[model samples]
Target: MVKKKPTNKDDNLVAQNRKARHDYRVLQTYEAGIALTGTEIKSVRASRVNLKDGFAQIRDGQATLMNVHISEYEQGNQFNHDPLRNRKLLLHKQEIKRLAKETDKKGVTIVPLKMYLKKGFAKVLIGVAEGKHEYDKRETMKKRDQEREISRVLKHY
Candidate 1:
């Protein structure tokens, strides 16, 4: 019997924005550390985060994550953080400059794809994306269905 070494890619995944892929064509991805308060970090560790309506923006030479919700910790009481506060994303100045330039293009934006814990710190995977048209989305769905059918048929052989 052979054992496979576990991959750490998603071992600590806290939240994911599945809709981001469907709505946008990702051009590039960057891993960034996120700033979180004590209660916010606790809530994130509990997997109480949402990336559905989240987006990232580069402002004043810094990257900020906006509209993401990290639910308040149940036991935080008076120290609980706001669920929808904008949080800073830790990225190098060069990366932030590049992202800012990329987003200057029409229809291109930065979005949070996933959040996970790395080395005891919270991290976010942000993507540079261009919005997909309706027809593009339909085509992608059709192609996915075709691939699924092909795999199913091959498995039966």
Candidate 2:
């Protein structure tokens, strides 16, 4: 029998952490599997999730994403999962070890970059990031302003 094509509902991007890019220097990225409930998945599909203040922790050989909120489903009834529950993130043993070592560095953190569905399963793109210093943030702002100014001048000319 021929294999059927996968559907897009399970492959769409539900939400993203746009602030992550601006606040940290992303050093490495890893795709991780997230354990989600039916209601939570539905809520994610509706784009009712937030990862702005979310973070991942390595605990007892597992990665858990905390503070990530997925709103309760409209018709979920009493079985709806907690909006801010800590969700398990699936990663390989070796990957988790690497992440643990990296996070041991001062100011390094595991930040969720985006959440999407792949092959009918929810996946999170996690980043090994280091927080940007004040000077670094100021430099980034200066560069952004310069680019905006150049764009404005070109448009007027």
Most accurate candidate by lDDT:
1
| Range of the 10 consecutive residues with the lowest summed lDDT in candidate 1 | 4-13
TM-scores of the candidates are 0.93, 0.86
Residue-level error in angstroms, candidate 1, position 152: 2.5
lDDT of 1 at 43: 97
Cα RMSD (Å) per model?
Answer: 2.7, 3.5
For model 2 the local lDDT of residue 112 reads: 96
Model 2 clash tally, residue pairs: 0
lDDT of each: 0.95, 0.92
Tens digit per residue, CA lDDT, model 2, 115-150: 988776888999999999889999999999999999
Error of 1 at 74 (Å): 1.0
User: Per-residue lDDT tens digits of candidate 1, residues 1-157?
Assistant: 9997775959999999999999999999999999889999999999999999999988899999999999989999999999999999999989999999999999999999999998799999999999999999999999999999999999999
Pairs in steric clash, model 2 = none
